[model samples]
Target: MATQNEVIFRLARSSRSVPRARALAHAVLSSWGVSQGTLEAAELVLSELVTNALRVRVPSDRQVGVRIARSLEDGLLRLEVSDAGSGRPEVRVPEDDETGGRGLLLVEALAHRWGVEERTGGIGKTVWAELKAPDIVAEPVGREVAAVLVRPGQWVRVWGEWRAVRTVDTGPYAAGGLAVVLGLDDGSALRVNAAEPLTVWNGGSSSAREGGEDEPG
Candidate 1:
């Protein structure tokens, strides 16, 4: 059964309506305080799904259905973009400097998890994505021992003992852990752990270069 937190939008399966669909998604996600990074990823996912729908399906007067649901169990957001098309979703590989065949791959990379579902009582499919809330932080060398890195517009998760530099001024983050900045030749390395999981949603300015995921937690 659907809960009160869920938001559903139905639109015509056309290129012009794509922006409206994204706006609805953003509005729904905003109530949850979803981070900006996550919002961008969500928008991309919606675009891919809608574009595929328009490309493969016949033009119809019926409105396409888009559903955004929040799972109360784990604070994971679920997105379902459904269409009235009769064909199944497929990703074609491109040769040379091709621009196609990479949409689903991008979705897989950005979304924590995703899948497809056949619509009931009609011919259609829903591409879905589940993103975990940004709550867990990666700390340096502490009991938490797990860390998440936000690199230039990317999110990487890892686990290990965090270490810091001797000269670098470690701010309040040192006590919590160091926010390691990557891609620098400052001859310094700092480590931090579990500093609010470095939310990529609303943080405007870049804090530091993202350290690579050393190991899985």
Candidate 2:
């Protein structure tokens, strides 16, 4: 009964402020009478986006922008977080002891579609996730497909069954696309169409790497 629309907000980047983003989502979608399941999915996606923005992007005096919108073309709702950092996000299969890599994985699993792109006229990236209405029929889950863009000559490790181990680099290009990797711990490895080989590098501090670079190949 209600028309699809968009809502946008800007706020400071802080772990403490993450809940505000979720509250805004619940408040705006309440008018649409979205189901509990849809609300949960929306909240989860919002949390992932905001968390990544706060953790990965260096907070500045300027506020991070959060945008909630509906796509009339597909009848889908999208949640986006844009920050002032040049980093991008990768959906990585984290180790059992790793404390942080799972956020993007949850986003990938819960949202119908999610992605990141460079922001215009700034040194930042905009991460987004989309979901259809709860009443909409769900799509069958199949082999997972993850697109990973690795820089040329950068090394990446693929975690999976011993027989399927792979290492690749993009040679001369700093960006690789659709590179596949698996979560050996969870027994789920999506098949990726590797457009370029990944370059390998020594393990470094957790906070040093930016964007999707932290992900396993």
Candidate 3:
């Protein structure tokens, strides 16, 4: 059994990358047997984080980094968006007349757990969220992400739906106890340690602005 688990993408800093990233996540997660409810939530989380990262002002040469990994502790799905930009993300109350600013609010609500941190080995920061991924039992006809038996051109019953395999390749091992596959493209994934809980911006009872920010993903 190949244990390498993770999918990493270095996307160009553009508004178009937002939809593309979400699509990639949906395809990969679906192929991995992620439940529909959890899959929807995960895509929203990814969208918010990626959208926010693109809003940050960074050097033209820099790109936004996205990572998707499952937690080994309990198969929780982790989503991370990192950028070489400025300014820490804060949850603030929006004006009553304001049209937008509710991103973090929704993130705090949808994600089972979410947070931000100083980017490791990078300039700015990374915003991440972890969604609960219920363990899927192996079915005779259906398949779980075994990383070996599952290959391109196979139709496997994922979670509860049937999906076609596209590509599968080993990736990098993320430090911090994550068995990530480096540079592994779509159709590849790995598990990681359940990361630290919400830290950077508190989502406890009271948030900074309380009311919230962003249109969200």
Candidate 4:
């Protein structure tokens, strides 16, 4: 009976949305304070799920949906991808000569538990994966309001896309409780609190800042 807070993003039906979904997942999950390993695995799982959803032969108007939520009852992080298509997606052993068909296999291995469910609208299915996400705090009062003052040269999620921070204008440290401004690569400035909410984009892959998340390229 716990209240659920989820970040839901609607992605256009295109192959490019795959990486966007992954980056969005990284933003949201990192904000939730998931471990580095869990964050990486979640990214991969989301990428595969989105890829498979796009592969489904759905109508042109059907867009893909991503939902990220935490099950407070069991303390598990849930990731879901919905597509308005038919039939179930199963993990089959690929032939030795095959070059593909291993997406779900990776999901099955990484997720603590995952399955497919009939969507509520009665048109398609939702593929979900749950992982043991420790250290994620309790649900916040506002579901969609996550913001943080970013540092220069770091990647941050703003307006549903990963943007690199060009510069940060902290105003003056003398003024307590003042909002911080972040100048992004898109030539947009965002003001936010220096609190725990907006996710700093780190893929946990390497030590290089530029090599972290692909910046605009």
- Which candidate gets the maximum lDDT versus the true structure? 4
> Against the hidden reference, what TM-scores do the models get?
0.56, 0.58, 0.61, 0.64
Candidate 4 lDDT over 122-163, as tens digits, reads 689999999888767764422332344455766665675445
- Residue 170 lDDT in candidate 1: 31
Cα lDDT, model 3, residue 50: 86
Model 1, 34-69: lDDT tens per residue? 778877788788777766666764666655666766
**What number of clashing residue pairs does each candidate have, in the order they appear?**
18, 15, 16, 0
For candidate 4, which ten residues in a row score worst on lDDT? 205-214
Q: Where's the lowest-lDDT run of ten residues in candidate 3?
A: 198-207
* Higher-lDDT candidate of 2 and 4: 4
Best by TM-score: 4
Write one digit per residue (lDDT tens) for candidate 3, span 27-117.
6576567788888888888888888888888776577888878755687888998889867888777888987677887788898888889
Worst 10 residues of 2 by lDDT: 160-169
Question: What is the full ranking by TM-score, best candidate first?
Answer: 4, 3, 2, 1
CA error at residue 86 for candidate 4, angstroms: 0.6
- What do the candidate models score in CA lDDT, each in turn? 0.53, 0.58, 0.59, 0.72
Better structure of 1 and 3 per lDDT = 3
In model 4, the runs with Cα more than 4 Å from the true position are 1-4, 139-217
Query: Candidate 3, after superposition: displacement of residue 96 in Å?
Result: 3.6
Q: Which ranges in model 3 have alpha carbons more than 4 Å from their true place?
A: 136-217
**Residue 110, candidate 3: C-alpha displacement in angstroms:** 0.7
